[model samples]
Target: MSDTTTVGPDTAGIGRTRTPTPFRRLLAVETRKLFDTRSGKIMTAVMVVLTVGAIAGRGLYAGPRLEVLIGTAGLSLGTLLPVLGILTVTGEWSHRTALTTFTLEPRRGRVLAAKCLPPLIAAVAASAFAILVAVPVTAAVSAVRHVPADWDLTPVALLGWTAANVLVVAMGLALGMLLLNAPAAIVICLSAPALWSAVARIGSVGETLAGWLDLNTTAGPLMEGHMTGGDVARLAASVSFWIVVPLATGTARVIRKEIG
Candidate 1:
C-alpha cells in the first residue's frame, strides 16, 4: 500500500523555500562591510595622501606644470587603486568573514554580487576624487611652473579610466568568488597581468601565451581607447573569460557546498 500526499506551496520541503535573491542581499552586505573596517579607512587615507602628494610634488618638483603634475600624480596612485579593488572583494574570504556572510544570506550569488558592487562603486568614486584633487593640484602646479592654466580634463579619458577601474574591480570580485581563497585570488589577479606582459615581451611561447592570456594585453586597449582588430578580439575573449567562467564556477560552489 502506498500513501500519497500533496503539500501546499508554502508547506513544501525546506529546500523549496523561497529565498531572497542573491543580488540585493549581497550588495547591501558588501557595502556595509566596506564601511565597517580599518581597510576602508586605509583606502581613504591613501586617497588623501595621493591628493596632498600630487599637489606638493607637482608644485615642488615638476615646476608646477598642470599636465605634467596631473599625469605624474595619476601614475603614482593608479596602481594602488587597483590593489584596493582586489582587497575589497578578497578581504572577506581572506579574513574568513565570508562564512558569517554566507550563513546570513544563504544565497551565494547575492553575496557575490554584494561583495562586488561596493568596490566597483568605490572605483568610480576614486576617479572623481582624483579629478577633484587634480584640479587644485593642477592650479598650484601651473602657478609654480609659470605655465598657462590650460589644464585638460578630457571627459572621454576620465570616463574611460573610470570604466576600466570598475571592470578591473569586477574582475577581482569574480576571481575572489571563484577562488574562495583570498591570498590566492589576489596573487592571481595581480600577477596574471605582470606574468602575461613579461611573457609577451619575450619572443617565444610567451608571446603566443601572451595573446591567449586575458587581462594583460587584452584589457589594455579596452581601457586605453586604442583597440585594434586583434586587440578587440583578444579583449572580447578576455572579458568573456572573466565574466563567464569565474561566475559559473563560483555559483556552482556556492549552491552545492556547505555555506559555513
Candidate 2:
C-alpha cells in the first residue's frame, strides 16, 4: 500500500566532512552584503553623492582650505557612516538570515567580528577619499583664487580624523548588534547626538556629563590637532561608553541567543 525507497552510497555519505569557511572569506562576504540589499545600496549611493556634493559646495563657496574641505565631507560622513555600520550589523537579523549564518559558522563571535571589519575599513577609506578629493578641489580652488592652499595638515590630525570616523561607525555597529533591530537602532543612532547636544546646554552637570561622554566635544580638539592630556582622558571615557558597553553586551547576546 506504500512505496519505499532505499538509498545507498550514491544517495548519501554519512561520515563526510566539509572545510570551514575562512575568516577572510567571511569578511569578503560581509563586505558584499553591504550592497546586496536595497537599503544598503541606497545608503551607499547617498553617501557617495553627499560626500562629493559637500566637497564641491565648500570648494565653490569658500576658499581651498584642506582641513575645511575634509571637515565638510566629515559632516555628512559622521552621521551616515554610523548608519551604514548599523545596517551592516542588523541586516542579517532584519532579513532573517541569522539562522543560516550561524548554522554555517557556528562561532558567532568570529562572524560578528568579521562583520565589524568592513565598517572600520570603510571609515579609513572614507577619510582617505575625503582627503584625496580635497587635494584636487584644493588645487582647483587655489588656482581660481590665485592663493596658495593650506598645507598645514599633520599626520596626527589625519589619524585623529580617521579615528573619529571609525569610532562613530563602531558605535553604530555596537548599537545595531545590541538592538538587533534596524529601524530602532538607526533611530537611536541618529537621535543620540542630538539628545546629548541638547542636554549639554542644560547646566553644569549636563556639561560635565557631555564633556566626558559626548564624543562631539571630546573628539573636537583631536580633530583640530590640539589633543592634550585632558582630552585623552575624556576621549577614553567616551569610547568606553559608546563602544565597549554595547559591543560587550551585544556579543554576549549573539553568543547565547537561540535561533528559531
Candidate 3:
C-alpha cells in the first residue's frame, strides 16, 4: 500500500489560478519587518535620539546653518544605518527563518531585491527627516544664540545628504547579502573604512588609492556641494568597487546558498 494525502480543493490548483506574490507586497512585508523585531525597534529609537542630539550639537557648536544641520543628522544616521541594513538581509538567516521565507517565495532574486529596497527607502526617509528637523532646530538655535540662521539649502545638498546615507546603508546591505550573518556583516560594514584608512597610511601609493577609491574622499565633494568631473569619476569608481561588486557577488551567494 502507498501512503497518500488529499489536497484541499481550493489550494490544490484544481479550481483556481494561483498568482505569484506581488513584489509590492514583498516590499511592504520587508518594510514592516524593519520595525517588527526588538532589535529593529531599539535601533530605530537610537537613530531618532542620535539625530536629535547631532542636530542640537551642531547648532550649539557652530550655529544652525541648514547645511550643517543636515550634515550632522546624516553623519549620526550613517553611524547606525549600517546595522539596520545588515539586519534587514541577515535577520532571516540569523534567526533561522530563511527556510520558511524561501519556501514561500522560491524566487531568491526577488527576496534579495526586496531586502535591498527597504534600506534605500529608509535612507531617503532619514534624509527627509533630517531636512524637516533642521528647520525647527535652526529657528530654536537662532533664538538661543541670538544669531541669524542660514537656510541656504539647495537641491544638491539634499541629494548629497541622501546619497551619503544611501551609500553607507547600501554597503551594509551588500555585506549582509554576502555574509548572511548579522554579526559578521555588521562588523565588516562598520570597520572596513577604518581598515582602509590604516592601509592608506602605508605610503604614497595608499594615498593615491584612497584618493580614487576611498568612499569618504570620493563622496566628500558631493556632500559638500562642490563636486567636479574628476570627483564624479572617482565617486563612480569607488561606488563600483564598494557597493556594486559585493552586491553582485552577494546576490549570487544568496541564490546559491542552501537553506537549511
Candidate 4:
C-alpha cells in the first residue's frame, strides 16, 4: 500500500453543490408539515366547526331582517377566514418546525412559496364552501323563520371575494415569516382590525383613514355587490398592504438571514 493517500483536486472544494429536486421536494415537505402538526389539525377542525355553526346559526336565528342575516354571513366569513389565514402561517413557527423547513429548503423564498400553495388552495375551497352553505342555509332559514334572506350572488363579486381570501392567506404566511413567532402574528392579525375600528370612532378624518386601513370596513363592498370605485380603491390598498408588502419584506429577510 502507498504510504501517502492519493489527493483529490483542491478545485472540487470551490464549486457549488446543487439540490436535485429542490422546489418539488420542498413543496411536498412544506405541505406535509401543514398536515402533520397538531396546530394545523386543530385549526382545520375549528374551521369546520365554525363553518357549520355559522350555517346553523344563520338558519335558526336570522329573523325578518335580510340585512342582519347578510351581515351575519359576512361577519362569519370575516372571522373564520382570517383565523384560518393566521393559523396557516403561524403553525410552523408555533411548532418550531421552521428549522426543519428552512433546513430542507435552504432557499427560503422557494420554501415560503411552497408554504403558501396549500393555504391558497384551501382558501378557494373554503370560499366555495361558504357560498354553498350560505345558499341552502339561508333558503331554509328564510322559509322557517319567515325572513327574506335575499341577495344577488354576483359571480364576479364572489370571485373577487375568493381571490381576496386567497390573498389574505398569503398575507398570513408573509406575516408568519416576518414575525417568526406564531402568537405575535396571531395577535396582530386579530387586534389590527379592532384597533382600526376604534380609531374610526374618533373623528371624520380618523374614520375615513380607518375605513381605508380597516379590513372590516373594506370587506363590506366585496361581501355585498356594491363594488363602488372608492370601495375598489380601498380593497386594492388593503390587499397590497398585506399581500405585497409583507411578502416582499419576508422574502428579502429569508433570502439573506442565516439559517440554523
All candidates: CA RMSD (Å): 5.9, 3.8, 4.2, 3.7
Off by over 4 Å in 3: 1-17
Best of the candidates, TM-score = 2
Colliding residue pairs in candidate 2: none
Per-residue lDDT tens digits of candidate 1, residues 1-260? 76988766784576786666557656776687776788777776877687667667666765644445555545534555555656776676678776877777776666666666777787788767766776776676667667766555456656665666666677776776677666787687767777778788889787877785656557656545565788778766776787568867876775676635
Across 1-260, the per-residue lDDT of candidate 4 in tens digits comes to 76998888787657677645567777787667666777667776777667767667766765434334434544555555555655656665566676876675666667677777877787788767767767777777778877676765566767767766666567677777777666787677767777888898899998988878666578677766578898889987876777678878877876786645
lDDT of each: 0.67, 0.89, 0.86, 0.69
For model 1, give the 10-residue run with minimal summed lDDT.
Answer: 64-73
Residue range 66-177, candidate 2, lDDT tens digits? 8888999998999999999999988888779999999999989989989999989988998888888888998899999899888778888888888888999999999999
lDDT assessment of candidate 4: 0.69
Stretches of model 4 off by over 4 angstroms after superposition:
1-19, 63-77, 142-151
Instruction: Judge candidate 3 against the unseen true structure and give its global Cα lDDT, from 0 to 1.
Output: 0.86
Count of clashes, each model? 4, 0, 0, 0
Write down the worst ten-residue block by lDDT for model 3. 8-17
- For candidate 4, the clash count comes to 0
Candidate 1 runs further than 4 Å off: 1-26, 51-78, 149-153, 211-216
**Model 1 lDDT, full chain set:** 0.67
Candidate 2 steric clashes:
0
